[model samples]
Each structure stands twice: as C-alpha cells, then as structure tokens.
Target chain A: MTIEFDAPSRDKLALEEGTSFTPKFDANGLITAVVTDADDNALLMVAHMNAEALMLTLDTGIAHYFSRSRGKIWKKGETSGNLQTVVDVLTDCDQDALLIKVRVAGHDATCHTGRRSCFYRSVRITDGVPRLISIDEHRHFVPSEVYKA
Target chain B: MTIEFDAPSRDKLALEEGTSFTPKFDANGLITAVVTDADDNALLMVAHMNAEALMLTLDTGIAHYFSRSRGKIWKKGETSGNLQTVVDVLTDCDQDALLIKVRVAGHDATCHTGRRSCFYRSVRITDGVPRLISIDEHRHFVPSEVYKA
Candidate 1:
C-alpha cells in the first residue's frame, strides 16, 4: 500500500481573528522572532518580526521583517534573491510573538552583508575577557551580486 | 576630578545563601540564563540553558549542556576546545530558564563538530521546499589542541 502526505487545508490554517501571532522579548527587552522551515522542525532564522510585518506576512506568502538598523519593513530577499516563502506561522504560549516557518528561494544568502544570516559572528572569552572570533577572509562567503546597488 | 573602577569585594561577589540563581521559565515555556563577562555588562551567548545543565553550569565553571542530539549532559569544550567561560548568571521575569551569555574561550570554534557555534547553518525555502544553506564548511576556526585529544 502507498501513502500520501496531504497539505493542511486553509480552514485548518485559519487562526483566531486578532489572536494569531505574538513576539517574545528577551532579558535585553528585545523582541525575538523565531522562524522555522516548512516541515515544522528546522529553525530558519531568529529575527524580529513586528505586528505590521506579521500581518503582512500573513497577507502575503513572502516573509516581511523589520530591520533594526534600517528601521523599516524589509521584504525578505528583496534585493539578495534570498526570499522567504511562508509555510506556517505560529506563536509562543504568550501572545506576544510569532514563529514563522518559511521556504527560501532564489539566493541562499539571507543577510544583506552577503552572509547566509545575520548571526554569523560568535562571542568568545579569552584570558577571562570577552572577544569576538574573527572569521578568516578566505572562509567567508559573501555574494557580490546581492550588495550591488 | 578623577574616577576609578573598583573591583567587587568577596562578600559582594557571593550570592545570598538560600537565594537560588536558577532562571524561571516563562509562560511561553522558554528558559533564560545570563552569563556576564568579567566587567559584567555586555552579553556573550544567548542560548537556552536547561535545568540539568544549568545546575552543572552552577556547580562547575565548565559549562555542561543538554545535547539535543545525544539527549544527555554535554560538557562544553569537552570534545571541542571552544569552552564557555561562565561568569555571572541571571534570570528573566518568569525565572524558568536562562540567558547564558558566556565568555567563549579556547579555540574560536564552539560547535561540537567544528563550526563557530551550533547555529552556523541557515534554513531556506525554495519553490515551496525547505532547504539548508550549506555554510558549515566555511567555518575557519578549529578546536584547540587540548580538546582535540
């Protein structure tokens, strides 16, 4: 016998009006948005997606986000060709944040600076002092086409 | 006029007896732990530190973690030289988990296998299919000699 995987219906995906998504803030008081992949398992990106962006994400299949530095709404992969295709959206127990699982298309890089994501840097302590581990220039992969204006 | 930074007294450094340092889990079921550097201001790693490992971290400066894969206590830098130098610990509003901002030390890499941290991989969606951006090989740093043995 053969089995098939059926996609969830739209009605099943319909969330309670005004009670679908929420964002959680950490100790630093910064809102955290946990995004996952389509299978509902793999975490994609941990970026902040605000209320407006959340609504836009729901309205459109593409993921919309608020860039902390740019201070504006950024459609994922708009310039980099690394667009996020929204599959499912969820929230933590608290109705303050959202968990969006998306499928990325076009370019594999998600960060504007040419890295796959914004969280490429790692913080380390040496000699009892905090320091950032520097990435070797040769090992770094930044697509030039994305950064070109 | 002049100003100076005075070191903390031994008494000041000690936690009050009977005062638990563990974090309180939030309504969202997320745990928070804080690891401060020597100066005690800037955050290092914002990782989800669980109960068992949290206790281990308190017991020993060498961080012990709950391996999502092995599902057991994993001592930080045990296999990899990227050890987390745990400094001060803190909790969130609810006090369930932790925001472990450790001073990462030893080899620049932290991931058990050889990446900078465990989160070097990025998930993306292409044509409604979830995919991973394979950038783990680009991680240049390797574990130090001590842990390699």
Candidate 2:
C-alpha cells in the first residue's frame, strides 16, 4: 500500500510548525517542484508532481514528475539516462511547493538538452526588447544521440 | 506602456534556441516562477506570474508575482518591506518556467514566517510516514511584529 498523507490542518500555526507532511495540491492536484543540484546547489529544473509521483519519490528516493503535456507520471531521465537520486526534499511555508535536491546519475545532467540545468540562458533587455542569451555552454551528453526514437 | 511579449514559436527548436522571450503560460495565463537568492543561490520561494506581473518584473527590475489565492497582482514584500530586486531572470529550455535571481531588501527575508527562504523544512520518513522537520531555524525577523495587522 502507498503511504498516505494527512489532510492539511486548518490551523495556520499547526500547518506551518507541525511535522505532518500534508501538501496542498492545486486545483489540478499538482504541486510545483524546484529541482537543484545537491553538490553545488545549482538550480536545475522545475517540474510538477501529482500525488502518485510525489508518493513514488518519497517511497523510492527516485525523482519522478508529472508531465503536464503528456498527462502522466514521468520517470525523469528515463530516456536520457540522467536519473536523479533524491538527496533531500523540502517544502515551503504553506506546503504548496517543493524543493528537491538530487544527485543526478549517468550523464549527471538534468536537462533534456544535455545541459546540467534547464536554465542555461539568461534574459537581457537590449534597446527595450527582452532577449534570451545562452550563458551555460557545457553539455554532459549529446541529446540527439541519447534520445533515439 | 508595458512591454509586450512575442508570441510563442511553433517550432520546437526555435522555441528552445531562439532569442525571443515568449513565455508559455498555462491555461490560466500564468507561469511558474522559481526564486533564489543572488548571493548564495538559496531557494527562496516558488510563485506564479501572469503576463502583467512578468512585464512589471522585467520592466521595473523588481520581483512581482500573481497570487493564486488572492487572484491579483502581488508586489512581493510590499507589506513586509522585503522587496526583491531582480538581478537575473532565466527561462528554462521550453520557456514555460522561470528562475529569478534577486537581492532582497529590508528584512532580507522571503517567507511571511520571517524566514530567509520559504523552504526552511526538510521532509524525512519516520517509521514509514513522511514528516517535516525544521531544518533552517534562522529567523531574520519576527513575523508577528513585522506583519502586524
């Protein structure tokens, strides 16, 4: 049987200070997850998690996410061989979001583009027009080669 | 006049590699925003941004978010004097999410609980039940006093 979570407490103080792990899912039963590199604390990727994905991550210590477009549980890095092993899972003040620190296996990458992080570019405004510029050039693996269809 | 974002590209490669700042908002016209400290890169908070909020943040160089609960634009830390000045704004591979690096002013705290980061607790399983534990106990200010109604 899958481990069940307690219903979120109505008591504001108890919800913030208590030990119960009652995550407040959105209307779609999804919660935002922020992923980071465990070693350097680098911001890697942001994904969503449904109840099942959250439970599996908690149970197996492997990172799993809900793919909004695919409408199913995604075993992250399953295709890219960059499986993420959970180092820590943290929740925010209201418990609506999560911060997941992980040690990535295989290519040690977290992005499908083979970059260590999905956020490999930074936004800049030039002549009042915002533009994205690539800042991180290092790729641990080749995406086309790894994600063979 | 607020800056207008370009329409999201139909081409997948262009969407990922293009310089345009076309964000993919969900059906509710909002995108996920992950905030972090500029100095230490600590995960500060996870919020949402509507088009107006995103435009304001980019134009004014200040962090703004859309509060899902309140259904309005939120100038973060406006009431508590913890205003965040954006240092860098980054979009992920698909441009559906954003990673905002900021230098927080005033109390230097992000959470309403007077914590530097909203993610101050870690989840751990005790006897096959997940429980949260207060990991970062450094309160920068007193919440009750700071947020006196």
Q: Which portions of model 2 show Cα errors greater than 4 Å?
A: none
Error of 2 at B111 (Å): 0.6
Give the TM-score, chain B only, in order for the candidates. Answer: 0.55, 0.96
Model 1 residue A91 CA deviation in Å: 1.0
Go through the candidates in order and give the clash count of each: 25, 0
TM-score of chain A of each: 0.64, 0.96
What clash pairs does model 2 have?
Answer: none
Tens-digit lDDT track of model 1 for B1-149? 11111222234212111122323333432353333333433222234545557556665666666654466777776655567876544332122333344676765655443554333333343443333333345444643544455
- Cα-based RMSD of the predictions, in order? 15.5, 1.2
Tens-digit lDDT string for candidate 2 (A20-115): 999988889999999999888899999999989999999999999999889999999889888999999999989999999999999988988889
Candidate 2 on B11-75: residue-level lDDT in tens?
99998888898999999999999999988899999999999999999999999999988999999
CAPRI-style quality class for the chain A–B interface of candidate 1: incorrect
Candidate 1 Cα deviation (angstroms), residue B129: 26
C-alpha positional error of residue A86 in candidate 2 after TM-score superposition, expressed in Å: 0.5
**Candidate number with greatest TM-score:** 2
Which 10-residue window in model 1 chain B sums to the lowest lDDT? B1-10
